[model samples]
Target chain A: MKYLKNAATLTFDPDRCTGCRRCVEVCPHCVFEMHDGKARITDKDRCMECGACALNCEFGAISVGSGVGCAAAIIRSMITGGEPTCDCGAASSGAKTTDCC
Target chain B: MINLSSVKKKEDCCCTPQKNKNFLARTPEITGQAVKSLSNITRERPEWVTGILNTRSGLVPIVTTEWTRTDRIGQIRSRLGGYRMNYSVRPGLYAVGAPDSSSDVFISANYKLSFDILRRALRGISGWILVLDTRGINVWCAAGKGTFGTDELARRILGVNLAGLVSHRRIIVPQLGAAGVRASVIKKQTGFHVHFGPVDAKDIQAYIRAGYHATPEMREIGFTILRRLVLVPIELNQALRKSAAAALVILIIFGLQPSGILFKSAWTGGRPFLLFCLISIITGAAITPILLPFIPVRSFALKGWLAGAAAMAPLVTLTPLGGTSALLDAAALIFFPLMSSYLALQFTGSTTFTTISGVKKELRIWLPVYIAGLAISIVIIILYKLQSWRII
Candidate 1:
């Protein structure tokens, strides 16, 4: 969670959150805080941008581009133009990749 | 009675005690003049039905299915000159048509998924698919275990009279099955070629379109987000419902009880307990997965414990006025994290990042701590309850 604030990799659009709180719930670092019935990343610094929030959002509120903190997946995705699954933002063919990101 | 002796033993088979009790009982026997009770099963095979029938040496022993049965069993039997079909292959193959010089022959496991995927992929292609009996498992896993290996593939090809059925010498197989199957040995034994296709069903269309050439990307294995996410629904539904119901009961118990605790001002309602339980649930099921990777610790259990500890912050500030509250806090601090960690640990089955050794190591290192934490929490809870009795 401490790595997320400055990472700027993930951005939260409160309008789309729907108050699901999945981000708040899934964040390992307690990066997200719900206030006045909306989700906010209060501990932005702690966010590793794992994209667990984005993946489970069910809404497009959370976006983290190709950078979700895993370096290998990103590298592979760049090489293959595939969507990255693990932290290394490699391009994977589909939303599924062997990587944890 | 049909003489099964005409059916040659495909290869090495040991009639151990257990094998006799199982497979021996199923072999068609001629004891009395038992009527061939043709079940009035008048249902015509659906268009999707490629084939189906009972198999030998299996728990159910039925291999034929309407899904794969393109024609009737009698037609198949007569077409093969009335040669008795060996039921030993649980997932067997049927070479349906006469072969021309370029007729392509494909190979697949008997696993329903493998069969369906391959056949569905080959839809209009006028080729043959040779299915191997892999005991109701997929090609990748079965191949890994040697069920779809060279010996079985070669033997099945021969047993089904494949040599006569096809003019072409090649047998295309899914690339994933290569782990167990020895291509060189299969080629030597059957004199048929083995061409490995892409690792996924979706890529089969492209492979066939590309003249049976598998691009390197097509052959690669993918555990993409979609694939990983599909597994979450069942687990989430089960965990959420069970934990919610349990948490509600615990909250009610904390609010009520002691024959008259509700009447005292020192004790509030179940709000606090409910809040704590909610925190635990969110952390256990929803949060653990969301923050799986960056939870600080390498061990999943530890990651959960850390999340639990962070969640306990509010409870620390809302300390109960009574000494019992101290004990209750300690108990909660211990139990909630243990519960969260345990749930997170179960996610290993769905995650690809962890090795078996890593999981074992985590369990060995953390299980004792989890158990101890839970034990302490329960003891403290009981002690707190008893201490509150005096104040009441």
Candidate 2:
């Protein structure tokens, strides 16, 4: 099913991309497409900012501000009137992340 | 949680010292086996049981019984406790229904719920369950995290001696895992072909029967109301904790109200004030989530605002407390809706209903409004208390 896209958090710099196709392998959203032996972000809005591509990318070609995009985080920010940051609570352990996954 | 101490002391081939930390980390598996290691298991005398074929690769334990389908008790336990986390299987290769040289090797995450899900879906089917060490995370999510990636598959294959067990070189993984598993890289590293199957486990039999071809419906994933609703309890649990803290803060503030010389009171009719806080929290955390689909609005924050106002409707009209101080009443009106809106905003993170853009848009427009309203309400409430105290 189609989902929401709020910001273009994902950016691809061809200069740094090694064209290893690792990003293509890691992105569940299919945000990246390979062209001319280099990785390119075809669907900018589709990036969930999971950071798999950025984490696995050897060349630092891919960058995305990945965080918990669930309502709880947003609600926490709104309630506390705090800056946007991941306050995912306990439910987050179900989903693994590159930091220690 | 019950068997951590008992299981911690027990050491076997699976619980080797080298793998102690990792084993301890797989708490769900320990609990599962502790709770349900079937003593009535009967095997079909599979050749691999006695270590018939000698291979250089490490030993791969095969689960024969209870592999064909999920145990009903475990299914019930998972349904009840899966959201609480700490539910997973031991990450390894398992033989389901007497899998052999030609049986399809199925890849699964270590999460017990995910394992049970596919096993139940594949009910009378025989296959080799090649589970990845996803640290109790599900396949789709682990794939996103790259735990279900090519390297893990290749490593697991080597560790389990999968090549020796099965003649077929193809591994069938869920379609959702396509993101992290580079099919080409898997082939290069493990000499095995990766075939992504249907998105849902229920479609596995059909996909395999139809020569590994997935129908359009099988490929599409959806977030229906039922699915969204199931996630509410965990969110509610977390919200209750946070709201309790908020409630205490509210109680302290309201209880600080001045008492005149006539009849002493910490709060001059504080029940209504406390009720307002309850309405705000319940509307945001519970009501908004239940009636999410029916509520019509551009953004979830607005929908919450509407629900919060509706909750306060009777209090606004029927109750005579607002007549005492207009400032306190106005502050209550603004604060209740803001609380609901903020709570509603949190649901976006847990649901598939919202997109990144929808959220960014909502936050941009509503966050500022809520902040301003909250600030003004706090000021008005403080002023009302000050006037009652004859301070200003």
Candidate 3:
């Protein structure tokens, strides 16, 4: 399902994108597209800011403030004081652990 | 020096190693004694490990594709949010089938289910499975958390001495893990090329058959009905647990008659309120997720609020409370929707497509509104109770 409009932190630069299409391959949301031998952000809103494309891109063409998008995690971090994480035990123990749904 | 040949000979005679047996006692020291020692301290070999594979670097534990009754039970338990945080496989190198030095290496999270699905997918294929320590989390969430990440990948690769065990310099990482693993960074650190495979482990066989090239479909994340449905049980369980406590407080509040706690009033007034609370929980936690795409609004909170309102409208108006108390009806209408909206907002974590920025924005706009609505509804209920007791 689509989230908020104009809420994604995803950004791309065509000059740095060598059209390697790594972003196209790595993005689960199909946010990137190849146009004129350069990578372009076709669906900016579809970006979940997972940082997959940016992490996989060797040319530094993509960037985003990627993280877990869960309200519970956000609230937990706010209360416990750390990066947002789902791992309940580790959140208080100062361990860099993250659990899943 | 340990007698590697003697260990190999003994392991070959048995189809399965006994539980708590020292699988590392006779193996070579180079095979990572740290993992073995940790396992030794635990005094148990993971039931998934059927035997050991004799390799050049060391002996690697071999896992089977078949699921035991416990694994199946664990899957169900995890789905229902039991033992979820502790369900994990040991983070190390493992063998599937009769893999050799020339076999391909596949990466996975330490989560038992993730490891199970990966091994099950490689039913006919022989490969080395390098599971990274993600603290029992699935790849997608761990990758987002930076546990299934670059530093961890590099460390695990080196820790396992993967170069000596595999002839190929390439490691196949799941596509979702690309969120944390940088192919270039991994290559630079370990001299191993990271080839992101398909998003789903089920597509691994096809991905390999296609020469490690994943079609767009394989890479795309699909939140189908089954996937969404699978996540609902945990949401339901969690919502119910929290609501149970809230329901108790509500009942106590309903029983407060200014003449102290009255059981009759609590049973009469609180029973209907409790039913509405359940309806809100189900709407927000179960219905909202299942009908997510079809819902009219992009905002999860709004969709949940709307759905909750729709579900409660008939109940509030048609129920006996409607004709008897207008204040109670108004309170029910307002409170239930807000409850649903708050629960629906929490479902954003279960969703695959939501972003941090989007959730933050949603919380910024909706949290205060939910608080205000809750306060107003509580005030209305108090007013109705005061009017009933003639205390005001």
Candidate 4:
């Protein structure tokens, strides 16, 4: 029944997760499910990698590879001196990686 | 437009009333009505409706308010047929009395709501308002469409004879109008300098009190919860009409076909299909906006898809139909949520939460999945048709 490969871009440090379901509440893809009162990335494959959860999280437990799922932002960044991480034609997937969720 | 021709004085409109005739000069006599009563009277009577006696166009007919002492329809019959009044003005002009030559001039759109909001901000102050005719639209929307641009502002200022009315050579404008208005062009035409004010009307009082200085925060646009919620109504209305019609069509198609035995079958019947459509509609429209900030997901389409998925749970877990069409119905269930999710994602244009680049990013990854989900559901439906028709 697996529809997508789990890239596991996010790493959850449960010790630091603070039981804050901000990660659980804000992910549009339903990537996180609650496990034993902690937020877990149960459906990582559903992640389109919008970093709202990480941006809003108070605890340093949740982290995702820094990449905005926005193709246009990556393209604009590429043209303006920054490396593109979005899945665009000329994006450097490795260059702009960050620990963002 | 002051028509002194019909008034008690035939003197120039610019001439200050005789010092004795000055309404503000001798104001010791307090009548039975309180100041609140007078203020209420001013607020209750709209400028646009009151101005109807002067300017009536033939393009639109006038509708009177219940507050009008006489039926407005009767009032229209008494006037010459050629004159038409468009009652589009609102109240709340800034005036303790008429402004003198020293008052600074400000510009605004002619839309009633915009005028009211701006004027209310200027309460108890005396200033000149140079309203541009944007054909009854707010400054932001009108500016976006270029109706409140340089040309209109220049033309309206000249048409209204602003130079003759005011001594000051500066006109303040809302900052949001800068998207379409070129201040340089307006300055060249009218000789009046353009100063951009705060984005919100409520901030105008503070802006005026601070000598028209705008802080950085005043110009920034934030999509607060209240602001996002206001836009939900139009989105829901659009979704209800389109999605409901789509559901009804699908239901009617299922009901009419002889091959659609699921319509009559108790195990996997039309009821579940109806429920599917309801879940899809609610998940996409009503639930998505309210829960958007809270929904755990990276993509809007995915969030909606997840909501749809949750909505499908009761059908699969609680209903007997899931037992008969376990696999087939499950296939249908998977795609149904995706359809709703994709439609909900398109609502980004109406919401202020996501940036254009962010939404584009969301769509790029999510649209393909949405299409694939839809394709899978259609295939399941076709297979169901085949089974009912005894073809497979």
In terms of lDDT, the best-performing candidate is: 3
lDDT per residue as tens, model 2, B94-172? 6566456889989999877788777767668777788898777678667755677779989988777777667889999
Q: Each candidate's chain B TM-score?
A: 0.60, 0.76, 0.90, 0.69
Residue by residue across B1-392, what tens digits does model 1's lDDT show?
11122212221222222324444324345111111211111133234433222122111111222334533442244223212122122344433232243667678876545565565666544555677876544565455446667788889877765665556677777766665565656778889866666767667768878987766566444445555444445335545666767665565556555775353332354556566766776676557767666577666677777887777755555555223476766766777777777666656544433333344456667767877886787678667667767752
**1 versus 4: better lDDT goes to:** 4
Error of 2 at B115 (Å): 1.5
- Worst lDDT run of 10 residues, candidate 2 chain B, spans B48-57
TM-score of each candidate structure, all chains considered together:
0.51, 0.69, 0.90, 0.58
Residue ranges of candidate 3 with Cα displaced over 4 Å = A76-83, A88-100, B1-43
Chain A TM-scores for all candidates read 0.60, 0.71, 0.84, 0.62
lDDT (Cα, tens digit) per residue for candidate 3, span B66-132: 8889999998887777566678888888888888778899999988889988999999888999999
Segments in model 1 whose C-alpha atoms lie over 4 Å from true places:
A1-101, B1-47, B50-90, B94-101, B109-111, B141-155, B179-193, B208-213, B237-299, B302-326
Candidate 3 DockQ vs. native: 0.60
lDDT tens string, model 2, A1-101? Answer: 33344454677889998888766654555667779999887766566565656766767787766544555455556679874444212234644321111
Deviating ranges (above 4 Å) for candidate 4: A1-101, B1-97, B259-268, B296-298, B318-324
lDDT of 1 at B124: 49
**RMSD to native, candidate 1:** 18.0
Give interface RMSD, every candidate, in order: 17.6, 6.6, 2.8, 16.5
Local lDDT at B317 for model 2:
60
What is each candidate's DockQ, to 2 decimals?
0.02, 0.19, 0.60, 0.03
